[model samples]
Target: MEQPFRVCIFCIRTFIHRVLEPPDDVKKLFQDYSQNGTMSMDGLLKFLSKVQGQNNAKEDDAEVIFNSLKHLNIFPRKGLNLEAFYRYLLGDLNTPLSPRVHQDMTAPLAHYFMYTGHNSYLTGNQFSSKSSVRPIKKALQNGVRVIELDLWPARNIKSVVLHGGNNDVEVRHGGTLTTSVKLLKCLRAIKEFAFQVSEYPVVITFEDHLTADLQEKVAKMVTKTFGGMLYRPEIDGLEKLSPESLKKKILISTKPPREYLETQNSNSPHKSEKTSEEQGG
Candidate 1:
């Protein structure tokens, strides 16, 4: 039913005419709570606490809600009629998730569900599309926490992030026509928009295809771009890392290059970086 007008537009003084038609069950419920065709404060409080599962709802909460839902200056803060009740059913008041964060923030990173962007560089196709930092910026702006970047050596000595770099010789979409975006541009984009939507940590997962030298360049680029915002674990294992502790931090997620690990193995007697690994929850 499109525009189910309950009252005349010209003669509307009591409540705003409901734009949506209510179902049979909703009408029955509205009538059930109605006393003299008006849902009173006590009725609303009962509906909220019992039917809506707002267990902590009290008299003042009911009054505040009742006052907010009534037709503003058109009606006094007395009760909710069918129109007001229908509006309440369609409004932001009825929600599954809390409007505010109510859970404990002091938990491991893995314990939480984070927004992740897959193939964060590519703008379109997997095989032959131009990769850009715009999508990364959009993802960050939308509160994405995990961003996946496939890092590869550019034609020159610079580094670039792209998709479909599965080929051995060239960093392309396996030999297809996928274009690439510069790593510096992606990092700068991340740095600019990472914390705009949220204060929690942002994880950059690099699908590394660069050589040892390019890896060093990438290290420099990441460090310079993020600066003090980068998260470095104080202890060897990140056992106690939590969302509360890592507020407004950018984190790195990638395996060290084999060339660098081999160099470490040859330089020291112990296995060093190779044998060192930690399990986190």
Candidate 2:
């Protein structure tokens, strides 16, 4: 049931009592919860009041907010949403209008990837088929939620798992037309191989060279062959896709500059960007 005027009045009275005389333990609990990203607006208000009363000497509200946020697991990992918090602190709550409480900062776990033509591990030794599965296995073992793959398919018929050109195969096979191999074998190999290492679901992200049906086919294959491990669809021009499409299990493999992200958050209707092969597949 909706809260009526009497309910609002009761809530207002409760809030007044809370602000005027909050308990000592409330501050500690508020600090704990705020650090964990579990703090509510009521908790924050109580905590701020406690801090103000304790210090009679004024403190920077920004510092207090940052200290509270430092407790979250995402802090020092992903960039902080400072602007939204700043607005909240400065905005007039009793005015005709107010900004949102806090812009959503929740994000899925992500892993960085860089593709190489040759299967050389970071140790500079050629990877055996046994060793070839090591990097992927490690990612799975560490509970990596996403795996980015780079592709350069001339025709959408075969999705080549490559970020850039492969000259090693050409040199070995000795022909101009004999370019990189285009087959599902490598992708299938990762799936079959990772299953041996971990049971947790893995989301495979693909970066293709602007093909039409390739994304659809890959999406089908991901659902059919790999138990829906695909995390991205139509790797290029993600800004063009509708909002609903962007919100599914799929994510566009684009990491724009911090400035771009801030600008988009402030002005643009879209949040994703056009990814370069340099950022990872």
Candidate 3:
């Protein structure tokens, strides 16, 4: 018999009961935490803090419990202490503010984590309009804090979710083709889907791959659709452009390296333009 799927409410975690077993220690800790009604949230935090500092438990085991508690709202929502707790749990010391093993007790984790839906999907044509919606909805349903979409310019330079294209049977046409959805349609669909899921503060990030003209149009469309809800990451070439310009236009991926882009003079005419200019001169 096949196992049933179960979705956990607290952390928006999900699993197939048949295929996976819960970690015994983690299960015991959670059961104990729930049974200890007298234990305050602060006490729980302190316990985890101490456990994290001791470095006795394997890092992987500790992280599973920490994330589980996070979904259960057992930890502080935000603060310096929570930040340190996250760093300790992740075993990350890349930042300058790494928690001190002995003296530091504060550092609060950020309240949210962002993820994309298509990560685990095995479908080759996963970028299509229909195929993409399932993961997007799943992410929203599972409390994915933020979502990123790769937008490519299609016919008429219209933006749509997908980076590149080829032939495939699962797609609308028999074989692989280009994206058929428009930027506006995608935005509206996302807004409606997110609203239905009751996931507020949806962060929609756009990874734009388009020409200058198309970028401007896509940016305007997003701004009109979501107002300030849309997010565009800082690209390398864009630093020279004013913030206002960026806000008004869709941001492309990190621009070509400054050295390469600068070396090619914009004033040089194209073959056609050069021929015309030379003939006129």
Candidate 4:
């Protein structure tokens, strides 16, 4: 038998108290550097260096450290606010405590850990399961930033989302299957629950296998459902957008046009080579 993991409420409460109400020495240190409720960058560097036991720290070393802190949004352009400085020292400055900082947005896209959900519309196993919009609602409420939508064309209906298999396009686990959920219902649920948890953007990864007419319907549904919240390169232009810029927006990640894919392949260094052996020759 397996034992369930449990959280220690007493430990959590004690930690929260320590964070919310810092020790006297920590408060005294903040007071020492604070001037008119703010501390200059130079003063902050001096304090940090001293705390790290780097006595008589060089100017270059201090500047490097300051740059890193600025990246974390710990220091403002001129100085640091008293409360913000305290939060930084206590290490509760990002996300659940506050909005993501500029540094968090400006980092390379590959660096961030995207909270993702696979087959988001399924309530149970894929083989035999009931499809429902509730899973999307719950996942978004829990701060999932990326969701997968598998689209297929239906006979009587337009388009629906489900895990594909030898069986019909319905929600199912290994062998068990459930009724299919409409694509529109899932989209509406996504729109409703997206910003409830976090102001961050939501990405929908579409696995589309639909007829041309059904594909058009899917496009129309997305436009109608998301409206102004949709991220369109035509409207915003083809510039590198940061996470901060995309807050409260819904972005769709799907297969690119054939021409676009061809262009990308043409640009590859080994485009003409058939294989590693050909390239070497």
Candidate 5:
């Protein structure tokens, strides 16, 4: 099932409003600190001193802290924007809503443990199950940074997502129960939900079984819908990207080259290799 775009927007807006709205006590504190619709640096220091009463503030330390707040635009040359000040003090206005882990971004991609979602389209059992875009929204909301898509060609339709080995092109579970969702619907859901929970990049792993024409359609839709948010190797380049460099972007991981796959298969250990030479002889 596909959720309306407006519904997604409304949910995001409501969440933002809830987070940014100050509580009654906070509002009263801000009002008490404000003089002429703004709080002066002195007033802010007083409020901070009261909150940190146990730790005595040194003359130079207070000046340095005040300067830092000024640098953050929390305090302007005229005075402090009380609403902005309150939000900053409460740590509610930051994009990620959590402190970022300081890591060496130049490290190889293998070092990171990506938050991944498996078989993201189905809301229930893989066989004889229902498929919906709701799963994508829920995964992203809970911070699943990598999502899977199983794509198949559909007759008289562009494409659909399903899990079945049958040659039939419709979206179904075990070639039995049909799902109403299509490829575009799932793509739309991703676009809507990807960045809501976190500002980090999202990676989509596609398992595609579509004709070249339909694949082109998929590519076009992705580009048109996601626009600058979708990562392009031509612009961003083919080098291994660091987490910092790929922030707020969407990346797609497709099947590797046949040669690479063949090499992997050849290098893989087999049961035959474990057999004793004497037994084989």
Candidate 6:
């Protein structure tokens, strides 16, 4: 119930009105705090401070929360009841994710257990899945900070995602009969939705099977699509790069040519290692 006071020029009077709504166990708690079958601002303030851990909670803060959850048509008009409390707490207002970035973003990317999505482009089973941007968008929207894409040459066309013409490289699972999603299109989707939910860095790990030329083309496409949002490590080791320093940045990772060649040579019968330019000299 609310005791709203009113004074009309010379006349003065007061009126009382009511009403409210949370869950069963929570409902018991709410009932415990309420008075005279109505939840007033004081009860809510107590709940916020003690139960919800808003230790420094003030009446104003409680008012804000109550106003948001309180039923407009309820008797008190500005009061929260059992149902209102239950519904708001169970709704999006009570999302598990923190409203703002609270963790130590200054730590190295390795220090964080990022929400990673393996083969994020596939909509179904890996062997016979359709490659599309829907999954990519959903992942980004749901706060998947790391995405994996396997890049290969496009079927029948070198390129298709970029604006100029065909995207020479496409994304799919390697050595499997799976559909492909254009690299540029994927990049575009990443660019568009990467930070929609959180202002954190997104790492894209590539299972690259493209040749040197196609790799160059992909690099261009990525640069064009992401523009300034792409993280180009100005320094050497990624160990020094912190997540705080890479906010809103897109970091792409793939095996280097030297590493790829070394692995291939290790599997060969002759195992003849080619000399690098520096060693050749």
Top model number, lDDT:
6
Collision count for each candidate, in order: 1, 0, 16, 15, 0, 18
lDDT of each: 0.75, 0.39, 0.43, 0.69, 0.68, 0.78
| Global local distance difference test of model 6 | 0.78
What tens-digit string does per-residue lDDT give for candidate 1 at 171-263? 233345788777777888899999887888999998776687667777777898899999876865456888888999999999975556777
Cα error, residue 163 of model 3, in Å, equals 23
By summed lDDT, the worst window of 10 consecutive residues in model 1 runs over 164-173
Alpha-carbon shift of residue 205 in model 4 (angstroms) = 1.0
Q: Model 6 Cα displacement at 14 (Å)?
A: 38
- Stretches of candidate 1 off by over 4 Å are 1-18, 21-85, 92-94, 156-175, 258-281
Model 6 C-alpha lDDT per residue in residues 79-98, reported as the tens digit of each score: 67666666556766567665
In model 1, pairs of residues that clash are 164-173
Ranking by TM-score: 6, 1, 5, 4, 3, 2
lDDT of 4 by residue, 175-274 (tens): 2345567777788899999999788789998876655555676787789989999988766453557677788999998885444467779877786565
Q: Each model's RMSD to truth, in Å?
A: 10.5, 22.8, 14.8, 14.5, 13.4, 11.3
Which candidate has the top score in TM-score? 6
Lowest lDDT block of 10, candidate 2: 166-175
C-alpha RMSD of candidate 3: 14.8
Error of 2 at 254 (Å): 7.3
lDDT of 3 by residue, 88-159 (tens): 334443234533334321221122233444322112364342433555556666755355554554543222
Q: Against the true structure, candidate 1 has what lDDT?
A: 0.75
Residues 1-281 of candidate 5 have per-residue lDDT tens digits of 12224456345322223336668887788788778768766766677677545245555644554455655534667566665566556553223433446667665455688899887888887766688889889999999999887766665422223533222332323344546467677778999999897877899887765555666677777798799999988664536677767778999888743445666677767734655454777
lDDT of 2 by residue, 1-281 (tens): 12224455346322221113334564445445365434544444554566434223234543455465565433343323333233334434223442222323232232223222232111123321222334544554554535555444343223334543221111111112223333244355456644443333344554443234544555455455554444444565434443223332433342333444566576644323333333566
Off by over 4 Å in 5: 1-108, 155-180, 235-239, 256-281
